[model samples]
Target chain A: MLNWIWIGLILAALLAAGVQDLGLVQLPGADAAVAEKGSRMAAVTEAAFDSAKTAVNIVIGLIGIMAMWLGLMRLADKAGLVQLLARALKPVLRRLFPDVPDGHPALGAMVMNIAANMLGLGNAATPLGLKAMEELDKLNPRKGTATNAMCTFLAINTAGFTLIPATVLGILAAAGSKTPHAIISTTLIASGVATITAIVTAKILERLPAFRLPPHDPPTADEPGAGKEATR
Target chain B: MRELLQAVATAVSSWAVPAMIGTILVAALVRRLPVYEEFVEGAKEGFQVGLRIIPFLVAMLVAMGMFRASGAIDVLKTIASPLLGAVGFPPDLLPMAIMRPLSGSGAQGLLAEIVKTFGPDSLLGRQAATMVGCSETTFYVLAVYFGSVAITRTRHAVVVGLTAELAGFITAIWVCRMVFA
Candidate 1:
């Protein structure tokens, strides 16, 4: 059903796009001017190449840093840095994710994901996301609807992460903007809004009765009493 | 068109391949490092992830290649042009956007073309370059993510990712606007 809904939305979007292409709507003033501006933009593309290099460098640099970081983090584990960090943050994470079991294995993965993203090392974040999902899958009390926690996590991931602003800053710098750092504020605002949006959406969706059904559901372990509501 | 092809060939052979190999070589060297034997398992994990993702990268790249060959890109550009300009995107950036989604090398080709066609410091060229830098290769990202996860159901990923690219596009334009305009 969700698949069909997704298909419908995509189809609708495509059709509307097609109609728009057919000239059913007036072209925006910006686009007309923008198209005209293309010839000139060719000039800027050259400079943009120089500017674009920073982000790629950062990304590539992050790759190297990750291997070192990973190796170091393992060393940190032996040296008790992770324990110290976790010990300090345990109170906060527990508060943020209340229903999650205190010893939930996902705590490690989630923190790891957050940290990697902060480094602008999204490629590095995948392992943690996968591990987090695996851990979450184990604790799923419902064999049905995605839980509030799951929904919330996905929302946070999708809404955008702001800790590392390299990608945007790199673009700004490449564009030769004097205010490359300007995005620091927007990052905070945008990511915060996204986070809030995700949290609210996840919570609301969790309460919806229809979410208890199959197919629209996240696969989960057998949980007592969770299935009774649907059968009723 | 020749420049675009050249850039892509360069990117594939020079940039991407070298980086991939260099990384592996570095890893290989580290493997010879006497720091610790226990780290091998973790090092091996990275190798496995790379292995899993490579196929996806190749597949998506091929799809992007097809998209370029299909002339669907010009259509996309015509559609995105207005929004592109309003955000202060130079027209040349359209090709970058068109090519960017498909491959970094191809985008680099477009970027180089813009630079060659125009002065490097030109507003449009700079903006297009910036856009290329700021965004991820959508096809590459999809390939890596899906291939790694082994997902049969891709869900709303393609849409959401494209939407993110649109956001990146608008952001690039706006930044260009505020600075260049």
Candidate 2:
């Protein structure tokens, strides 16, 4: 999937640039139409370089933020807060991931990861999420293929139900808005809906014929049939 | 009712991070954990994680930047505006709605530009901000999370992510209108 999306972006960029250069399609704005033959393509060349630099800068810029958040997360973990939080959420998580056993380490990592994400701590979220993925993979009999638990977890991550939206607020504040935080409630409502949709869709798709994992020998004690949903 | 929710949301957004950090420190202190040493240890991994993602971020962003600079995004936005406008979503937010799922930095850049052009208090600016906040970078999340585990057959994860993002984007616009309009 990533292979084609990456290829398609580059291919589409070149195609669009070529078409514009050939005078087949002009940009929508008056300023764009006044540009010379090669300038449009030149911009694309410049953007590639600029974007590469931006990518590196973004990562570098995140180092401090990541360090702080990860540091705090570690402190939380050492204090047993992460475990307590995970234990509190066990019932809900057990229902969400029926395949994982009652007291798997994956559950703890997932709780911390989702908690980090909700707090808008992207720096902490990714590492914790990957940890959860690795833990979940321990149960996978089939290597290099995602389990239902992994898919459901990723669904929640990608929906991104942020509580603070700190980045957005910062951007708006920097822009000198009178009420930079006004979108907070709206964002919560929207992201809340997205999170719900993601969970529902992932759960439903897991049961679909096309998406169901192929049957394999039961590796875990609670393993129901691979393609079949476990009856509660 | 709306004003009260807005005020509470504002207060929470402002204080949540500090409160979280403070609570963590207090908790660690109470537990007699070597907070400084443990933090340093975890932060060491943070550096490596940051460096590990360089190649992936560069690859994704370069492609996205080129696509945007080639004016394909503009063309798409132009084409999408009328259809989207008929549904009451501001056309200026189309770029945000499009770039959002693909690249986080790209969407933030667009959001900054949109807010600057439209004024941060404008209805369009508010909607764009809400939209970006409402979703994650779906492709980035998929690549990093699945890539970490060396999983290739993602099955329906991509579909689920995109579907969820679409739902978020639409809901952002609707909620923004209801609240801000």
Model 2 chain B poorest ten-residue lDDT run? B5-14
Q: Which structure among the candidates has the greatest TM-score?
A: 2
Model 2, which residues run further than 4 Å from truth? Answer: A29-38, A49-82, A216-232, B1-55
Q: What is the TM-score of chain B alone in each candidate?
A: 0.65, 0.69
* DockQ for the candidates, in order: 0.06, 0.57
Q: What digit string (tens of lDDT, one per residue) describes model 2 on residues A1-232?
A: 5678789998888887778777887666724533642466787898899989987897788777767766777787778776777678888988899998865667877987897788776766777786677678888866667899999999999999988788898999999999987888899899999999999999999999888887774466665556655443
* Model 2 / residue A214 / CA error / Å: 3.1
What lDDT does candidate 2 reach at residue A12?
Answer: 85
List of chain A TM-scores, every candidate: 0.60, 0.75
Give me the candidate number with maximum lDDT.
2
> Which whole-number lDDT from 0 to 100 does residue B7 have in model 1?
56
